[model samples]
Target chain A: MTRPNLQVALDHSDLPSAIKDVTNVGDIVDIIEVGTILILQAGDQAVKCIRAMYPDKKIVADTKCADAGGTVAENVQKAGADWTTVICCATIPTMKAAAEKIEEVQVELYGDWTYEQAQLWLDAGISQVIYHQSRDALFAGETWGEKDLTKVQKLIDMGFRVSVTGGLDVETLKLFKGMPVYTFITGRGITAAENPAQAATDFLAEIKRIWGE
Target chain B: MTRPNLQVALDHSDLPSAIKDVTNVGDIVDIIEVGTILILQAGDQAVKCIRAMYPDKKIVADTKCADAGGTVAENVQKAGADWTTVICCATIPTMKAAAEKIEEVQVELYGDWTYEQAQLWLDAGISQVIYHQSRDALFAGETWGEKDLTKVQKLIDMGFRVSVTGGLDVETLKLFKGMPVYTFITGRGITAAENPAQAATDFLAEIKRIWGE
Candidate 1:
């Protein structure tokens, strides 16, 4: 089994702060996600700036695009994003347009999905899926429990490169053992930490321990 | 009944072209929408440029925010947008977070809904509603023959600022007469025209004739 990658989600309100944090921990992170908030806050320039700063690192623009897929895909590609995300709920025409553009750039779907939505996305030729673990439940004394592992396995079985996200921390990382995840994405866990580099190093250590990398 | 404002939606893929077009017809356009494509393409720089170029115009960032409303609102507001859009399908928390950001930033919802959704938005403190017409049907030899003005009237009666969009042209503009529309948002009808300024002027003239402004 391929080892899962670590993607630091830069979902901050400002580009300078996000860049500063990424600069501190870019060495440990495999993929850098310009999260939805970052994309909305700074637009494509955020992607461009990050791409310039880390010339070889993979940068994914978390657009969460629901409509006008071709336009969004083309724009992000021009901004130096290696991958752009579309919402699973987007219309078929929009998906088709996005897929066509994906020939030139990578397109991933970002949303929690039922079995049917996952099947539909596969049918639409989307290979990447972002599975969000709801923050509300996590913050309200709920644990990162069994439900996610099952969902992750199901999506992996369906031939998707699944990315897991939502309030991920050291405790929750243990729950993902033996899961065929493509990338593990965490936001506040790293950016909000007192020592971002150490936090990233901790996350990398945990991943290596889980996967024996 | 209030005269419908003429909103020119700049959905261009580049800032220079969008700025050029807006400057050409900025005097006649009531609301300048830095469309989703433009925002995603150029980032908040697009909003800042438009606001700087057209200081008196009401600049709207069509962020189409799906989640994390406060972050999206603050970023765009920092970019100098007068209003920001939230997807109608967004959770209540997202909407409330957007509303809490700034009094000047109006939240616009887009979706096909019964009157119940309008009431829900009103109760939720959303002041703007977007009504979408199908562009495919409009372009495929279909007319506004089976028009429904009652929905627009109903939304207006509920005290929402309603905007009508989707391939809006002179032929279709006639059907909206007597409907309580707050704004008519035109994209391709103006932006794709051979002479965009003239096209904007013609649209404004038709709107004046209909509303006797």
Candidate 2:
């Protein structure tokens, strides 16, 4: 199995703070996610600025698009995002439109979604999926457990490059000890840490320790 | 008994085009929507710029938020949007977070939503709901018909200040002749017209003809 990539989600509500977090840890991270909140606050400039700063880094614009898939995907592509996200709730047509416009589109698992939907997304030419534990769900004390793992495993088995996100920390890394997670996305796990660079290094170390370098 | 508001959707891919459309019909329209595509391309700067130009206009940032509701809502609010949208697929917790942070939150009806969900939105303190016929759906030949009207009527009966959108034209306005629509959101119907100002005027005139002044 290939080693999992480490993606840092820059979910800060401001561009300067997000940029600061990236400046501290950008070198260590494999992918930079200009998070939804940051995008909403700062606009596509968040993606443009980050893309300008890290020319070779894989940038994910976490737009969480629900409709106008082609337009949204095309816009982010123009802004320099390598990949963008669409909510699972969006229709197959939306997915098809997005997939047609961008390099790659990830289906963000949110609210009620099904494995059947994942199949359709693949059929629509999207191979990336992000299994998310939402912030509110996390705030309500939900944690990653067997059920989430089961779904992730199922998605992987179905040929998705499955990524995991939402309030992830180093300790949480141990949960997926032997699983072939495509990427482990961390936001506050690193950005909110006292030392973001050290936090990123620790996350990378954890990924290597669990999945083997 | 109130006349429905005429809200122009600035769904252009860039700020300049959207601004030009707004400039053409801004004074006559009751709401200026910084559309999802524009927001995706330009970011909150779209809202901020529109707000700067039309300081007194009620700007709607069509964020179509799927999660991190409070952050998205608050960010748009700070950017001078009077309203922001949350997708129906978002959890009640998400809607509550948005409603708590903003003056008002509108649930943008997309795929697989129910009156039960609308009640939950109301319970979460959201009163506005935008019934969307997605662009993809329109492309697939989905038209506004009886089923959609029934749902819109049901939502109105349930006490939501319902707004309708999706490929709205002058003739489509006649369909909601007797309904109490809170707003009629038009995009290309006006913006893409040869005379955007004339199209906006025609919409206003049609609203008066159907719903009465």
Candidate 3:
């Protein structure tokens, strides 16, 4: 199994703050996410600026686009995003429209999804799936848990590059052991830390230790 | 029954173009929507610019916020939006956060929602529920049809203000014959017309004719 890559989610409201935080940890992170909040707050300028600043890093614009797929896809691609996300709940026609628009960029579908819905997205030719742990469940004393692992493994078996996110931390990362996850995304755990770079390094080290990278 | 108010959805990518279009029909439109595309393209600047240009107009920022509702609500409200939209698919925690942050602004929710979901939003203190008509459905030769009316009335009886949209035109306005729709939103029909002001006036005229306002 391939070792999971680290994606640091930038959920800040301003570009300068995001740049400052991410720049400090850019080397350790394999992917940089313009989180849904950051995208809505700063718009395409945030994506363009980040792309300009770090030409080598893989950037995903988490538009969480549920409709008007063609327009959203076209706009984000023009702004220099390498990947854009669409929700699993979006109509197949909308998803298909988005896919057609971003033939040059990677399209990821969120797997905070039902088994039936996941099958629908994969059938629609979406290349990736994002397994989101519910924030409510996390706050209600749930760990990554066995059910999540089973679901992740099921998705991986279905030929999708799976991404795991939601309340991920050093402790929770262990729960993903033996899963064929393409990437592990963490937002507040790293970006909200006093020393973002060190936090990123720690996350990277944990992933390496777990996966023997 | 309250006569449906005509709303013009300005979904352009640039603020200047949007302002020019809205200025032409500002006198006729009852509500002006800073559409999701515009909000994503220009950020809060789009909302602020429109508010500055037309102080009396009721502006709805179609942020379609799926998460981080507090940040979106606060930012859009500060930008002078009278209302902001959140996706119904967003977590309940996100909805609660948005409601808490809304001081005097209305929160609108959209998606393939049921009456139960509308009830949940109302209980969460959301002000309005939007029943979006999908463009792809229209493209696939489906009219607004009968199902929408039943859904609209069901939501209205539940004390929720229902906004109906999806390529609405002069003929489509007739479909809501006896429906208690609070708002009738038209985008390309008005904004993309040869004479936007006249098109908007005609749309409102048709609504008045149908609703006997």
Candidate 4:
């Protein structure tokens, strides 16, 4: 069984706070996502600074590019992003342009998509899929509902790498213990904690306990 | 008989060039969109700098937000964006959160939609609709087809503040001249020219000639 990777989503609007959390918990994080707000707030420097600090972990730029595919992809890749996200809502051609630009830099593409657009993205050769449970749903005390899980299952069944995000916590993660989730992207659950390192360590330990390393 | 506003889409990856383009063409341009690449490369500081430099024109942060509505909206608004864009592909509640956040800051929402999602966006009260032409389609030498124009007509009939973009130039602006396009977003046609001011002037002149503004 493939153990799910643990990705830390750094979404701080400023650089110092984001760096502090990464410094605290970098060891346990298998991947780091420079979240949409951070990218919008700090620019490519957010990813570059994080990459310079933690070159070992994969850095994902959550630019959520809806247009200007070549420029957006190259900017993020040149800033040292190993992977970048292209929103599925952008046209198939736009998505393709983004994917091609990332390819030029030898970086991977993570298609942030809804279920209806799954087959189309898959057909376009998008490798990884991010199934985002809306933050509103998470804040409203929603669980990882059965329908969302079913989509995850379908994506996994379709032979795609899948990551799940949206206020993920250790308790909710345990529900998919044996599933092949490529990554569990947690932001507030880890970075917002009193001790970020300990929170990340706990999350990693829980993953290992269930998936047996 | 409302005249379509001329918008300079600043998509430079850095500040100086973007500022230069605006300085050259700011007179004819009614709105200035800090494009996605500029936002990703320079942060909200991009918008703030442009707003400070060109205070008269409307400033838009083309964030194309894929998630985390509150933070993205707040970040752009704080940076002085008069409007911000949200991708229609994000979940409905997520889109609403973005819309509400922008409204809270007294800024407007530019909902970037694919045709299929138009009615849903309108029903959800997304005020402005951007009919983006994929950059890829333009590169493929594709003209704006009837299908695309039909949606524009439909949205205009439905009373949406519709903006048409995708490599719009002086020639194409004539096609939609008599139509009530709320805005025409032009990037390279003006910004990439040897004389950006002249290019923009020509575009504005064409618009005025056709619409008799």
Candidate 5:
């Protein structure tokens, strides 16, 4: 099994904060996700800035695109995204257009699918999936529980290149040490740290230690 | 009967094109929508720029936020969106958080619910809905047919502040006359024309002629 990469999520509402933190962790991070909050707040200028700064790094424009699939997919990829995320509920037409656009651009598309919406990937003919842990749920008295781990295993068993995210920290990451997630996404986990570089380096080390990458 | 407002959607892939087109029609447009393509390609900078230019006009961030609802709602509104849209499939937790944030900021939330998902807005305590016409369907030889119009009437009867969008041109706008649409969103309908100002003015005039605004 191929080990997953550490994708640092820059969810900062401000462009400078995200750029400052991304510069700190860029050496250790494998994928840089310009998160939905940043995308909605900063726009493609963020994509341009990040793309210019890291020409070789893989970047994900997490648009959570629910509509206007073709136009968004074509343009975001043109703006220099290696991957773009579509929401779980996109229309079949949107999904089909997105898949075609991704292929044409030599990029990839992942759907943010919930348990009930798992079938959407099959319908969309896209295999990559992000099994998100809701931050609202986390703040509303729920912890990342056993079901989430099992869900990850289930998605892997079902032949998905699964990605997991939700306010992940070092302490919480121990739970998925040997799991077959294709990507481990961290946001405030590294960005909020005093020394983001040290924090990201530690995360990389931990991933390597756990998965023997 | 409340008259519908002319909302010019800036769906351009480049920020400069959107800015220029919006500037041409700004005086007549009641709402300036940072369309999905603009939002994904330009990020929140699009919203900030338009907001700075038209401090009095209503701006829809059109994040189409499907997850991390609270953070997106609070920040986009703070970034100067008069309204933020959430995908119909967002989790209850996301909806709850978004509703609270929009209310706290004294803005609005519109849910893009499909036919079956119409009740989600009521469940989320949001009154606005968008009966989106999928472009994929249009390309696939599926026109925005009668079922879509009926669905609009259904939503209005159900007491929703309904908005309709998707490749709306003047010919198509004539079809929705006397309907209870709260807002009519036009992107290429105005921006794609050789004379975008004349196109937008025509749309505004037609709206008044049809709805007696």
Candidate 6:
């Protein structure tokens, strides 16, 4: 099986801090996510500025569109994002609209969703889905468990390039030891670390350790 | 019943055109929406710029938060938006997070939602909701019909300040003649018109004609 990729979710509320994290660890990570908070606070220019700095790296504009998917997709594509996201609850037409505009569109799994919905997304030509443990859920004291693993496994089995996110840390990497995760997305776990560079490196090292060279 | 507020939705892809529409009709319209498209393309500054231009006008940042509600609400609130939107599909916790941060939060009604769900949002302390005839659904030949009116009426009965939107035009306002809509949101109906100022005046005239001066 191919190794999973390490993606740093740059969820900084400001541009300079996001840029600092990217400057510190952009080379070691497989993808740089200009996260939703950054885009909301700093604007689409966050994607443009990061794109300018890392011409060759994959960048995600986590716009998490719920509607006007086509317009949102086109906007991020122009800003140079390689991938963008739509909420899983967005309409099938919304998903189709987004998939038509961008090279890759991931359905961000939030709240409650069904495999039936994932099938429709795949049918609509979207192949990537992010299984999230949302911030509020984390704040409410939820944790990654067998139930999440079962859903992720089911999606992978159903032909999705599944990426997992939400407060993931290096220790959490050990949970999916044998699984073929497409990508592992970490935000504060890496960006808010005392040494972001080392944090990023540690995440990559753990991935390599678990999934092998 | 009180007259419904006329809100102009600036769903333009760029800032200049959005600014132009605001400049032309900012005085006539009751609210200015920094539409999801504008926020995605131009960033949250769209809210700040409009707030600066018309300090007295109510500004709605249509952020449509699916998660990270607190962060998204805080971002738009700081950018000078008087209100922000979270999708109807968002979790109750997500809705609560957003409501806690902003003075006013409107749940943007999208695909397949229930009064049961609306109750959850209302219970979470969000009193405003935008009932949308989504653009994709419109492109697929959907229209504002009895079912939509019924749902809007029910939400109003349940204590929500119901705001209706999507592809709304001057003539369409005639349909809700006697309905106690808290607000009527129009986008292309005004902003994309040959004369936005005249269009705005026409909308106000229609609102007055329907619900009286």
Model 2 residue runs over 4 Å out of place are: none
Per-candidate DockQ vs. reference: 0.35, 0.71, 0.43, 0.53, 0.48, 0.70
Per-model root-mean-square deviation over C-alphas: 3.5, 1.4, 2.5, 3.0, 3.5, 1.3
Top candidate on DockQ is: 2
iRMS values for every prediction: 3.7, 1.3, 3.0, 3.7, 3.8, 1.4
Cα lDDT tens digits, model 2, B1-213, are 789999999988878888878899999999999998888777788999999989998999999888888888988999899989988888877888887778888988877777787888887778899998989989988999999999999999999999999989999999997899999999999999999999999999999988889
The CAPRI classification for model 4 reads as medium
Q: How many residue pairs clash in each candidate?
A: 1, 1, 0, 0, 7, 0
The window of 10 residues in a row where model 3 chain B has the poorest summed lDDT is: B103-112
List of clashing residue pairs for candidate 5: A41-B44, A42-B44, A43-B42, A43-B43, A43-B44, A44-B42, A44-B43
lDDT of 2: 0.89
Please give, for residues A77-171, the per-residue lDDT of candidate 5 as tens digits: 87788888877666667677876776421112222345444555664577777777777767777677897789788877766788888868777
lDDT of 4 at A181: 88
Candidate 3 has a DockQ of: 0.43
- The C-alpha lDDT values of all candidates are 0.76, 0.89, 0.78, 0.78, 0.76, 0.89
> In model 6, which regions exceed 4 Å deviation?
none
lDDT of 2 by residue, A1-213 (tens): 687999999999878989888999999999999998888777788999999999999999999898889888988998999999998888888888888888899999887777777798888778999988888778778889999999999999999999999878999888988889999999988988999999999999988887888
Off-target runs (Cα >4 Å) in candidate 4 are: A103-116, A140-142, B103-116
Specify the CAPRI tier of model 1. Answer: acceptable
* Residue pairs in collision within model 2: A43-B43
Superposition error at A139 for model 6 (Å)? 1.1
The top-ranked prediction according to TM-score is 6
Candidate 1: regions farther than 4 A off: A103-115, A133-159, B104-120, B133-159
Q: Candidate 1, residues B1-213: lDDT per residue as tens digits?
A: 668999999988878999888887888889999988888877788989998988888988988776677778888887888888876555556666777775543444332344665576677788787765534334434444444466666777889888888778866788888776889998888888899889999998998899878
Worst 10 residues of 6 chain A by lDDT: A109-118
Model 1 whole-model lDDT (C-alpha atoms): 0.76
Taking the tens digit of each residue's C-alpha lDDT, what string does model 6 give over A1-213? 788999999888889989987999999999999998888777789999999999999999999998888999988999999999998778888888888899999989876677787898888888999999988888878889999999999999999999999879999998998899999999888888999899999999989888886
The DockQ ranking, best first, is 2, 6, 4, 5, 3, 1
lDDT, candidate 4, equals 0.78
* Candidate 4 pairs with clashing backbones: none
